[model samples]
Target: MTDAAARGLWITLEGGDGAGKTTQAGLLESWLRERGREVVRTREPGGTEVGTLIRDIVLHHRGDVAPRAEALLYAADRAHHVATLVRPALARGQVVVQDRYLDSSVAYQGAGRVLDAAEVRELSLWATEGALPDLTVLLDLDPAAARARLDAADKPFDRLEAEREEFHVRVREAFRALADAEPQRFLVLDASRPAADLAAAVRERVTALL
Candidate 1:
């Protein structure tokens, strides 16, 4: 990033599977762009080439991988993404919005996957070189409702989607617990609402940040 390039706001959306983060990330990116904010919307696992490869192994591996392995893989992807895309973009004053992040690893792999949160955070720091989001918008919703929506939408279940109902419930609660612990950094929202309403809520929160 040069002096002339813009600085960036790194905003990440965190939530359980089927929580509509992908849709919301897209909508938020468009809103930021419309307001003349340079934006780069991306996701974990497949942002950069290296990260993409890691994502495939983590997401589509034939056999089950350990929780630590899964957490490290996500951290690897995050490291590449931040070094290649996120950090530079933020340095240039772009709004680097992303779907999923280290929090997912901590909640899903650590708490949900039964890995230690302390270890997960340490690994994430190594992977991302300790880059933290300016704000984390956690789309809070019941795991049952999220699964129901995914089933209703007729989307194929991914590996994470294949977890037990109780697993997802723990993951969602972990996210809520994280937000509670870091109220200043989190904007927890009810993800059960209609899309338009959810989007509106997200925009309002982000607008204040801007």
Candidate 2:
């Protein structure tokens, strides 16, 4: 098949904080490019101009933004990201490997903030104009391990990541729930595995899907 004949592939990485999504995302990008596929590496919250502003508000918040309000900001950012970046890239038949997307909002703002998943998904549809990933790579990890990685990284965990331990636990559980809800769309792997091996496994999944 011609390069342009392949449908646009939206691959998202979903997990708790510090699940090594970026590292694995980069690996997939390079791997796909080697096969002559056009790659559009992007992320939610900051993929577009307006989205970047919303990202700052969401991540570096000075105080608590109400849960639903925070969710709305994420929705706004995603709206812009999908319109300005994701849709256009997909129209060109590029492989879109994102660091995170709708699932992050559902896990963080939905479960972490104690909102409804059904409501959150509806908001996502409205904001992203109904964009959904073809496949999602879930780096399932224990909350303790994920938290330790964040703490050891020596960087501020930011507003969402700076949530209480219990909150993070909820987020992790929410993500696992999401994977269960969409088995066909998710490649859920344990995070306790070696990074290299995990990366290889993720690569194999994306390779097979493409």
Work out the TM-score per prediction. 0.94, 0.94
The residue ranges of model 2 lying beyond 4 angstroms of the native Cα positions read: 1-5
lDDT digits (tens) for residues 1-210 of candidate 1: 222234668888999988989989999988888899889888897888898899878878879988777887888788888899998888877888899888898889988888888789889887777778878999988888888988998866778888899999889888988899989789898988887898898888778777
Question: Model 1: how large is the Cα RMSD against the reference?
Answer: 2.5
Question: What range of 10 consecutive residues in model 1 has the weakest lDDT sum?
Answer: 1-10
Candidate 2 residue-wise lDDT, 88-193, digit = tens: 8878889998988989988998889999988998898888767788889999888888889998999977897887889989999999999999998899998889
- Global Cα RMSD, each model: 2.5, 2.3
Clashing pairs in 1: 6-92, 6-93, 7-92, 7-93, 8-93
